[model samples]
Target: MKLTSLGIRQKAFAYSMTTLGSSLINSLFSFYYVKLFLNRYRISEGMFHQAQIVFMLWNAFNDPLFGYLQDNAKVPCCAKRHLSILYGAPFYAIAFLLPWFPWRDYQEGDWLCGVQLVIALCAYDGMLTFVLLAQCALFAEISTKHENRLQLIKYNQVASLVGSSSVLFCGLISDNMENIFNFQVFALCVAMLAFGCMYYTGMNCVSQYEHVEKLEKDKMEDASNLSWTSVFYLTKQIVTQKNFLLFIVMNFFQVFHLAFLNNFMLIFADHLIPPYLLPAFVKSIMYGAGFICPQLLILSSQSLLRKLGYYKIILSVFYAELLSATVMLVLGPSHHYVLSMFLVANMVMVSATFSLFNLPLADIIDADLLNYKRSFPLSSMVFGTNALFTKPAQSLAPMLVVTILNQFDYEKLKDNFTHSEQSALQDLHGAMFYLVCLTPICIAVLQILAWTPYSIRDSHTDVAKYIES
Candidate 1:
């Protein structure tokens, strides 16, 4: 379907609502879940960790399954790819509230607490994968024209920024108030907001785009007739594609870099504005500044993106990451504003690089389609597997921080820790320096190396022209 400008804006807005909702849901859990579970409820480290492992493994296994199901699902009055979102949105929002509402009857770290955590998390992850994969698949489903996809992607990025910023409420609450009831109320409110957005997007926004062509019944029967060995063969075929493989590696590094920053941001914050001095609302400001700057930078850099193209943009942002990290390292835990700027710079570089790399992902899918000569939608499979590759990096990031801190004998700052204790504070600062600066630089460099040989330009452009024609 050829979309008018208004149609484009409406579709983009609908698609972005999904991004906004998911981002809010993710930011809330990613930043606060551990603190609430461990400190507030006093869940045992062992039990909580076990649940984390289960969540990871389950997602690793099921993400592709849901992807495949979305690719093949049949339903009346719904897009094949949108079916999951339509059916799964309500379940997803309900599952999101699971971790926050633990069984009060169970004592802290009780076997029941662990069981509840695992079950809740598993359900949450399953529904999350279902809802998100469908939303993500829309990137490929909604439009293949370069400019149209770009418009959708840009809107998605803006929504993502808004969603990430929404978590500032937690920081504000933490800094300005002290009441469990307030926190619970905030959680409930956000949960409903997330659900409403996701439901609206799935029900209404999905129809704005042309749905993928469903395989006829005879074709479905023929596909089913293929031997099960075809599955392994197809998997091998995808993993072996040089461009796709490199994209997967780049995706992993991108996620790993972000994960490292998030895992250690608390320590990084300590180096800049210790919690004793950092009010929650001020910390929220710092986070908001850091989070929003990148999107702004990205929006401004669009002209540059047009000029530099994908590879050059990757190089530019990767080097920027290295430079920002180095400057932050040199600043070495000093003035709050200066430190915040450098931290934000590092984030800008990180987010900018991530966004730049994502611009090529759709192209990579195009390349796959052209090379393989497949006609049906493969966005779900491509993105599904990409999501699979990033799982380990997400799973490993927290553990990486813990291992590094343990190795350095880093002490966690308490409310009672005095400025007079320069030794422990310095040690903590040193850890943050490596985590934010040196390690990320190394990852970025490696990603640069992986991306150097990727030559998707000609093929991607050809696909774009062909699709437009």
Candidate 2:
């Protein structure tokens, strides 16, 4: 079963199609779901809160479970990473469409709406977990060389530029989400496009070394003999590792910051920027920039990524974010243009930084393999465990922001209408400013603290040495 040989560039492109597919659907869901359910559909805050609770609980269980299954299962599709994608992509696409359709017409406080939200979130998350766990596992399995992984990242960000444009495209077709039917039509098109990309990637991309590894019957037998006790021990070992602990702590805050911005950026733009000052089209472009510019920034930063390394680059981004947030806070929200620019820029930086997380994570996986003297990579388990800790931040971010906004009479602004009362607008604006600015300041400080002690020095050297052996 020799796989087709591909040059590095070809492999990178093929591999990155997974990113293109995943990001297309995921960015749409992450950025728009909160607004759609809470505002457009007019679901109550209490119901939204209940859905998040269910989502958080489900999110925690699924990541590690899927990771363990993918890594350990004897099923052919589960054993082969790309095959998993081929089988799972269609289901993932279907899940992406879940929230777009309401199962029933419902009045306010109807438990059916809450049920729909819960099912939408959990279904999408479950499928997403299965597909992406395979994609991420393929990332480590594809190559161990630092240079090779960076190539994959470069191609991925490029793909992300296209995939992430689903948001921009949706904005254009839906007239900034004012038309429900248009948005629904746009989503169906996106789901089809995403499935094609993922399916193509699965069929085309193959790990260069996997065929050789498959020849090792003894290792396969050993993997078959893996048991629950071994799984528990491995989980314990991973969780107890000091560097893994530090990384997840920092990542939790990073996820929280990203979730906050992605979920509510539109709401922020609608409320903070008056329509007369900045046209809806201009705001649409800005919203689109939040998705697109991050890739461009990361693409431009390749030299920095190579020279400074992940730790330094990440810390620099965090500190820069902290400083920028502080400055924005001091300046206040009086200037709508400045506020809008800051919000978009903040999302760009955060999104870009988040994109590079897999690099360090790959390093950690390499370190774990070495430390445990393991024959095979535990990439899925490591990523899944990390998600176990970080995914909750996704649910928590919306809940916290909504709770705070509710305190400031945010319910009254759900229609996204320009308020007539200047006094109420002023109060909501102040609250929004603090949420946008203060959150990063606090998160940056915490991330800096957590990340500073991370001791995975010289990932390139470590990974290169590991691969050569």
- The TM-score values for the models, in the order shown, are 0.87, 0.96
Instruction: Flag regions of model 1 displaced more than 4 Å.
Output: 43-45, 75-79, 105-117, 174-178, 206-223, 275-278, 356-358, 407-425, 458-469
lDDT tens digits by residue: candidate 1, 245-268: 888887788887776665456546
User: What's the C-alpha lDDT at position 202 in model 1?
Assistant: 70
lDDT of 2 by residue, 115-170 (tens): 99999999999989998888888788777777778888999999999998888888
Taking all chains together, the TM-score of candidate 2 against the true structure is 0.96
lDDT of the candidates, in the order given: 0.67, 0.87
Backbone Cα, N, C clashes tallied per candidate? 0, 0
Best by lDDT: 2
